[model samples]
Target chain A: MSEITLGARRPVIVRRRRWRIPGAAIPYLFLAPATLWYAAFLVYPMLQSLYVSFFDWDGLSPSMTFVGLENYINIFAVDDVARLALWNNILWTLGALVLPTLFGLLLALALNRRAPASTLFRTIFYSPAVLPLVAVGLIWAWMYNPHFGVVNVTLKAVGLRSWANGWLSDYTMALPATFVTFIWSHVGFPMIFYLAGLQAISKEYYEAATIDGANAFQRFRHVTMPGLAETHVIVLSLAVINGFKVFDLVYTMTYGGPGRSTQVLGTWMYFQTFQYYHAGYGSALAWVIAAIVLVIAIPYIRRMSRG
Target chain B: MMSDVRRQRRLEQTVIFLGLLALSLIWLTPFATVVLSAIRGQGDLLARGVFSLPKKIAWGNFAEAWSTGDFSIYFRNSLLLIAMKVPLGIFIAALAAYPLAKLRFRFSGAIFIFFLAGLAVPVQVTLQPLLVMMKQLGIANSLFALVPPYVAFGLPFQIFVLRGFFRLIPSELLEAARLDGASEWTAFLRVMLPLSVPALATLCIIDVLATWNEFLIALVLISAKESRTVPVGLLQFQGEYSSQYTLLMAGILISIVPVIAIFIFLQRYFVAGLTAGAVKG
Candidate 1:
């Protein structure tokens, strides 16, 4: 019995010895490329942004003077532009969250029942989400043109001539008008998401509700709504994040135009950093935007994880 | 009572269907207008209502936009970028994800969580650094500059999604391969990849859509007119012909065709891919 135990133990000892030296190293080999790439590209750049936030560095100029938190202070004290941007960001978040979600749910509810050419309608409805933002922006800008554009022409034909104005250029209407375009471009995405979520729900739930004398509203409220919680959370979070980062559409359509009335944080940051060359101030603004998103999202993420 | 309820449901369904038809029209009208305007000559667009039928169709607008906007070059650039970036991104992501999914490494969870944190970090935050790095690498304003950052920013999400997918594969299959004298690489290549075609197809479709439609990164990175992707090229055309509404619409229509074609062709995979990324752990 002793000799047999020794014979088995000898191989076990050798295997353990082999693991100690090479097993620890092998995983690192797998990790090396990703680790290196992340450090050089992601981590280092983040630190550099932080460092650059303290100095006034015109991206090309050799002269770098540290302004400490003056950039942050100036951004808060004298910049109504930044304030407007912050407000626009809030409006964007609200508009993006409410409009898309409600419209998507409505579309999904409407399309739930079989109809003629339902699949074709569904595809057409979802097509906008696939188009590039620039294409959408350019298309809408043409439609919003003051003369000979589709929107104004339609408004005039409908005898709403008083409402016919340069929608993209008007101070009172530009942001909301632009928001409508943005909403139009993005509504397809949420619609599709909601549709998928709605489809995932078993018809049995609705059937059970029907047996229990539940009407359409009740079925939707209790069955569809609850079934769609995960989709809502994902969509809501994405909407908020994308709202906070609204750049391309604004940049393409209005250019924060007609006296910066349509400015959002992203375009503001772009204007300050790349256009105006206030790198430090723009960095500060970028950080503030990041900080706001982090504050809102981290708690939400934690809540989500717990659930 | 049951018959009455059924009648009411039928009425509600009709109302709902009509409402959806209106909404879908609202959604589709803008795109339809662009397509119509693109095929109509400038005079026809002015003479008729924006949504009215064109008296004369100018199928030449597509060819005009293609030639004048130099879209052939832009299309080629976009195609090249997508071709290179998608495979590179997927390969890197798969390689990175395999160990995270299958290997019993000590820091694998930590590493993965680190990448998960990347999901919240917007590309805007990384733009400046990426620009600087690209400039330093001497590839700024070129297609090469666009590729690396595209891969880098894309890695975390791809790896995260692919890892979730890889985890869903049965461990017994992997073990069987291992028992058959297959090394880890061989096991991953032979056993795992074949099982992952559906997931891969989904990822490929999503990647193609995203990279094809991507604007901001291209806007920041590619400065040369000749090097610009379709989106950037459209912006340039807008600048050159800001008042020429018909021409601008033509450009918009041209730029959208490739993406729409891809979406229609692979819409099932697109829907599956998006939802999987959204819902998966």
Candidate 2:
């Protein structure tokens, strides 16, 4: 009887102890480092940046005069460079949505068959995506060189010399030219993503579609497209976010050059803050970008959390 | 009719093969340009054009680039950054994730959401303020300036991965450890961590690769000559060797070889890590 009583009481004692604040300290202890880190580097700085957006100050100034969203109004109303950048970003977003996804899906479908050479081809195609943007930007820059670039040389050799122009230097051509390189590097990522999605698809779907007298194109359109909708969400959402935040590639390739024709919000933000010393204006631009990305990203993240 | 169908199918296969081959060739052009240009003599590259075959392979361009290209320092710096950042960041994230995944804590849901929000915030949004903060911290030009931010940025994803993995682990094992009179901490250290090798490995691969090729943070924070990483070094090398195609190509080759070799050797880890969330890991 005494032993039974002791055993029953033991759990209550432990539970009571565990429920106390001191006993619950372990989880908090575990969480502390990450908490401290986020508060210091991520959260605090973000809030600080938002505060700075309302001021009129160079980065080094000893004083900041509060301007009350004047910088935001200024960019929206007066800044042609920002307007141009917004336009280019829209173009980029459209291109990013269509071109890379189309090519990636096509490549993935073609390579989904178990051909012996398919693995090698997949690796080769995926190689460009693995390379540093700095290296990719430079190689394309060199390829677009005017005097003796391979692009021009090949054009001349093919008897279409008139088709060749200085690819990077021409204002109208520069962004598109940069976009071509962007696609070259980018398509492989979505290809890999789609390939993974394709492989997960059970063979029964295709077989059933075939039995229903669906041709290859019809099967692909109806079955494959809906099957990979999750991957489509992941790819398209990421593509849009990356589109808004593009910087390193453009910076390395052209530095928004030959004019500001190729400038996107990212480079323009850098130009405003670092080059022009308008830290206030730049911070406002950053806030706008953050808002746009969050508008797209939060829903996806919430959906992911639900799963 | 069956023989005709077979023949048509074979012809279609041939067409597919030719199409893939053409696309593959187009994909390889930039790599081919970089490799071929790296081997040609600089004078020949300048005079005869980039398309011209080299008189002899200038294999020594790599040697010259290593000594003069500042890549040696940059390479070491990148190596050092990853070495310090990856393991430390993963450790912190893993520790934090354990309680969130296993233990009942107040506000854990809210905390997870906060971390997830970090994913949406662009680096540019924080760039200006971060610069000033680093300056105030008096670590602006040093490698230390990068560590907190890198660790902080990497945490959300890492915690998300680890917590999900931890949740997938059968709770009975942890319960058994607790019933065996082990402390929760010991259960975590021994049972949870040992069982988490694959997830941890996936995180390491992703984190290391990101740090190795990280451009923006290194560009913004570390401007000291000795503190630069491979990407920044390559960018600067471009300015100096803008006319020297062979040398520039050599520099590019040197910078990318380590990462490409790593990817090839650990291709499965890379592909798996990159697609972890999209597919069920």
Candidate 3:
């Protein structure tokens, strides 16, 4: 165990004749396949992405110029869409934080008491959350269609014809229109969390609050809010992370725009890398996404590892 | 006084019922649009209105979308990917989970933490380099190229759940098996996996949904028409048939129906697995 003989002289190999393989190596053997996949696909590419970010390389050719910090500087100083995408991500995070959190809690509150046909109502409220984002996005896209869309059709039927603008085409409306679809599909997520959080709250707390002469709102504020604090953390953190990760919905719905007005970091990165052949700039964008996700996700990861 | 109380209760119930009904209808409008849009002719839709009842139900849209939209190939490829990917991912995860959960090793804690860090790394970050690697390896557009990335991305979550389930299993069972001359692999195969079936099933369902709907990686790594999964295939369909609204809606429904049906029937599993976050300190 001496530092001088740390490796070569201190072999602790078990010399049992009955053993074919060393006992100490079994876990590593068990770990080999998953580790290999992660190393090859996830870890290697992750480091490679960082390396590739320092260069001006179209993903196609054999030549790449090492353009030190030009790509990173371009993102911060030069790229208009990059700034817009950053603002869009912040807007998306705020929207995700507010709308889904509020509506999901409301749905959880309304259905928490298990009234008549409550299960069916729960199913209805949650169904949109379960579908593929592409399907969900297209469904909303159809509803938002300028000419024959149901939103315009419904408005026209009600004789508010002028109010029926092209919901997905208008610059101001397009981002919010896509956000509405995000809310529709995602509100159920936080609802399920709140519903579980509500169930986990001991009934005795409510009884005690009632005995203290509290009204429903007071009891909700004092008891229910504190009880669901952990759920709130889980929901808000995940919503923020998914906010950064948002691609499928925006990609499917608006493809980041009528004129890049709907661009988020994810779809912007996609277009830059694949569509425009700006691999270096796109890698920088991807790293930005990774950086944001890591900051939000570290606590969740640490908590998971403690198990 | 009793009669008054009963009247109040009945009135409250009625109000609740009506409120629920209104909410359900609002929540269900998009689905209603899809259902109606899927059943009508293009002319009928544009002529009558978006919400109009079909004068004659066109059952042909599903047939046309299935065949003409190339959705048949997409569905087959998606299902094949799911069948191939989920079991292999879970098996590898279970193997990795067993030692991380049970065996006391020098670096178990560090290794576990390293794997947890993978959870925070976005798949988008891995795409460009993985695409390059795949191209260099000459397997870029093949359906099987997705297997490695999907499995790698799935591992952190899968191992987290399976290891949580495994840790809850009494260590004495493994000790007893070892005393009976069972090797570590035997102890794992015979003692650990069978007890973790519930966790494994939940992982299966979660991975199935993820793999089916996964788009960006598949979109980036896969370019061949024959290898396109459901999500990408439908996107291509939308571009090709921008005017065929009915057919596109039909295509959307056809893609989602199976998973929706599974969700309805297995509602409990979906809730339990999805909400199994690591909030516990």
lDDT by residue (tens digit), candidate 1, B198-217? 88878888888888888888
Candidate maximizing DockQ? 2
All candidates: CA RMSD (Å)? 6.7, 5.6, 7.0
Best of the candidates, lDDT: 3
For A31-75, candidate 1 gives per-residue lDDT tens digits of 677666766777677667777889988866778899899878877
Candidates in order, TM-scores: namely: 0.92, 0.93, 0.93
Candidate 3 lDDT for residue A102: 93
User: Could you give the interface RMSD of each candidate, to one decimal?
Assistant: 4.4, 3.6, 4.2
Local accuracy of candidate 2 as per-residue lDDT tens digits, A207-292: 99999999989998999999898889888887888889888888998899878999999889989998899999999988888888
Candidate structures ordered by lDDT, highest first = 3, 2, 1
Give the Cα-based TM-score of candidate 1 against the true structure.
0.92
lDDT of each: 0.80, 0.86, 0.88
Q: What does DockQ come to for candidate 2?
A: 0.49
Q: Where does candidate 2 chain B have its weakest 10-residue lDDT segment? A: B272-281
Candidate 3's C-alpha runs over 4 A off are A1-20, B1-17, B278-281
